[model samples]
Target: MGIAVNNINKKFGQFTALNNVSLDFPTGELTALLGPSGCGKTTLLRIIAGLEGQDSGQVLLDGEDASSRHVRERQVGFVFQHYALFKHMTVFENIAFGLRVKPRASRPSESVIREKVTELLELVQLDWLADRFPPQLSGGQRQRIALARALAVEPRVLLLDEPFGALDAKVRKELRRWLRRLHDELHVTSIFVTHDQEEALEVADQIVLMNKGNVEQTGSPQEVYEHPTSPFVYGFLGNVNLFHGRVHQGVLDTGGMRLDVPGHAEAEDVAGIGYVRPHDLDIERYAKGAEGIVVQLIRAHAIGPLAQLELARDDNAELIEAVISAERFKQLDLKEGETLVVRPRRLHVFVDQPSHHNQDAR
Candidate 1:
């Protein structure tokens, strides 16, 4: 079943945590609520789970209102950052806790409960650790146990709040891939909240980007990355270089360099800003009649497959960065203090006025 949040609003005293936020989580697909801290992602998640009440609006689970339901009745499973496993319980016992706690009339028989726990342990590939206590398991192993426990109850929807946050980087990466595979196999409707962009991009089928209690954009990883709808979206998604200038006709003049803006329909002469990602920047040795901005190289470092370069505009001393392939860097043989012409292979322009119109890459 799908979940729909309609016109949800929440406030904590004078501060508005969520302002008229609405979103749809498709059935059997993973959705990620991605944002910085204090952006209301967690608040919205809690509200959907019936752990927090909304000031206004309703949460619908499969087209039925679930806003007033108790957390247990909602049939939603939650996994937090910490494993929250009982130190005294073995892995098998921890996984069986949910089933055992059910009312006697609804509880499964002891033999059935044991079988279910065994199946869940095999599903998580930790059947060997069934007898080990949480204190004896590694951080990653503990998280796997936690997820197995969450699934033991057969939740209608699974919600995870940074479930892998406490693990080490290597473990986090490994678990992300594992989780993606697990989600595909289980086909459970799941939503997870995280501030890590890479995790969202790699693990989720849909991403809802939130900021300041508002949704900036919602799309697949590639859609949002290739076509950002706002300056905030562009800046938040990846490394971007910003240029402040004024637009005349279709040209942006930054006092030091002019960028040719083609197919821009805005007729009003106004200040505008331009954004170009590091990989979109092209660098060449300076020469006459070159159609690009002239910049002086401050430094360059070859990191694995890419070379990161710091450059400054000759006319205004504006700083920008460019990342190029190591092979290209070697071909150019660039050095510190060398003059180079920089051009954007693709650019995004936005009008800096009362109404900002974001121009997609062209």
Candidate 2:
């Protein structure tokens, strides 16, 4: 099922949670509402689920208005971060609860419920744990059971709010791949809320980046990451090395350093900032005469296939971060206190704007 929110507005006291937000979630595609906490991603999800009413605007499900529908009447399955499973019930019973609680006329027979629950358990690859209690299962197992319960009613739409947020890093990684495969097989229109960029980038077909109660940008992960519309989006999407500079003729001059800005060559000079990803920087051992910024390496951390380096500008002590492949690091034979020159291969220049500081993003 497709979901659409039109001109949605909501407020609490003097605080506005949603600012005339409008978006369309494509049919049979998984969309992610991604943003920092308190950005209204959760509020928007709740409104779509019919658990909270929007102050204005309409909620449409499958092209029909669903604003007046009750929570249970919406046919939306919701999975939460903490795995809100019933501790007192066995996994099988929990999955069967939704089917058994339907109105008498709609409720399935006992044998049918048993069959459906078994099918769901196998679908989630936990049929063996059907007899286990929620507390007896691992965190990952409990979350899978929660998902099974949500799917038991055969909802047309599924909503997951940080479904893997409660798990450790390793388990979260595992479940992310699992969820992506499950969605591909079912193709139920699904929307999940998450602040983790990697999760959204890895799992969702579409990404809606929200900020300050407004939708900032919407696109596939590659679109947003490769062609960010604003500085906020650039910084939020990945680690960026920001250069406070002024643009003149096609060059960005940051006091002691200057970099080429070919895209702005024909435009009038203006104060701007340059954003470059850490991996976009090319670092080399400093020589008597180097063309790029000279810096002294402060630290190097190599993990698996990549290495992260911390360096301070030789002239001003400005700290910079650079990411290079482990093989490159080995080629350079870099060590702390070694002087190096870094040239930014790609630079994105944006007109100077006040920074949007999110405690979580930093």
Candidate 3:
């Protein structure tokens, strides 16, 4: 079932942790709560699991109020970053712990518990490690066991708090793919908190990007990356080149150069900012009649398939970076300290108005 958080607010003493946050996690879909540390992603996850109470508003599980429900009654499966496995118990026992500890009336019989534990172990691909102690298992294996334990209770919703955070980079990547496949097979409504942009982009069907106490934007990976709604969203999602200047008569003058910005007549007589991604910039040899910004190349590094160039504006020495394919770099044959013309294939401009309350706000 889907989960809905409506107008939720939370605070710690004088500090506001979450401010008027509202979100929807679609039924049987994996959603990622993504943000930097202290952005309330973890706090929101805890609140949904009934582990923490909100100062205001409600959490609805399939349209039923779940705010007052106890953690166990909520039927939420939670996995933490650390492998909270029992050092004294075997893998099979760890997965059976949840079922065995249930109230007598609801607890499964001993034979049933063993069967269920066996199934979960097979599902997590760790049946071979059933008799191994946690200390004998690898980091990835322990995490998989932890997830199997969470699923043993047949939770309605799964909440993972940086579940792969303790693993190495390669292991983390592999586990994310595994988790995605597991979700597909089970179709459980799951929400995981991650500070990693790549993880959220790769693993989630929907993404909620939060900063401070507010959600900056919510969309699929492609939607958010292609069309960022705010400056913070653009900056946080990827690299961006910024141009600050004054706009007049559809032209922006940065004191060093002027850019012709058509269809921006309303921005006349106001300060404006322009943003362009490194890949959107086109570089070429400077010609006398060339119509583009002139910049001097500082250095060029060809690493793997992409070549990165460090450039500086000729007039004010403001630095910029451009990334292109190695094939294009070889064709251009760029040299250090040489003047080059740069044209932005696409640009996003916004009035230079910063919001005091929401820094990412337009």
lDDT of 3 by residue, 19-123 (tens): 999998999999999888999999999999998999999999999999999998999998999989999999999999999999999999999999999999999
| Residue clash pairs of candidate 2 | none
- Candidate number with the higher lDDT (1 or 2): 1
- Steric clashes per prediction: 0, 0, 0
Error of 1 at 53 (Å): 1.1
Evaluate all candidate structures by whole-model CA lDDT and list the values in order.
0.91, 0.89, 0.88
The TM-score of candidate 2 is 0.95
Model 3 ranges off by over 4 Å: 249-251, 255-263, 316-318, 353-362
Candidate 1 residue lDDT tens string, 50-157? 989999999999999998899989899889999899999999999999999999999999999999999999999999999999999999999999999999999999
Q: Estimate, for each residue in 32-135, the C-alpha lDDT of model 2 and write its tens digit.
A: 99999999999999999998999999999988899999999899998999888999999999999999899999999999999999999999999999988999
Highest-lDDT candidate: 1
Q: After superposition on all CA atoms, what RMSD does each candidate show versus the true structure?
A: 1.5, 3.7, 3.1
Of models 2 and 3, which has the larger TM-score? 2
The global Cα lDDT (0 to 1) of model 2 is 0.89
Question: Which residues of candidate 1, in runs, are more than 4 Å off?
Answer: 315-318, 354-356
* TM per prediction: 0.96, 0.95, 0.92
Candidate ranking (lDDT, best to worst): 1, 2, 3
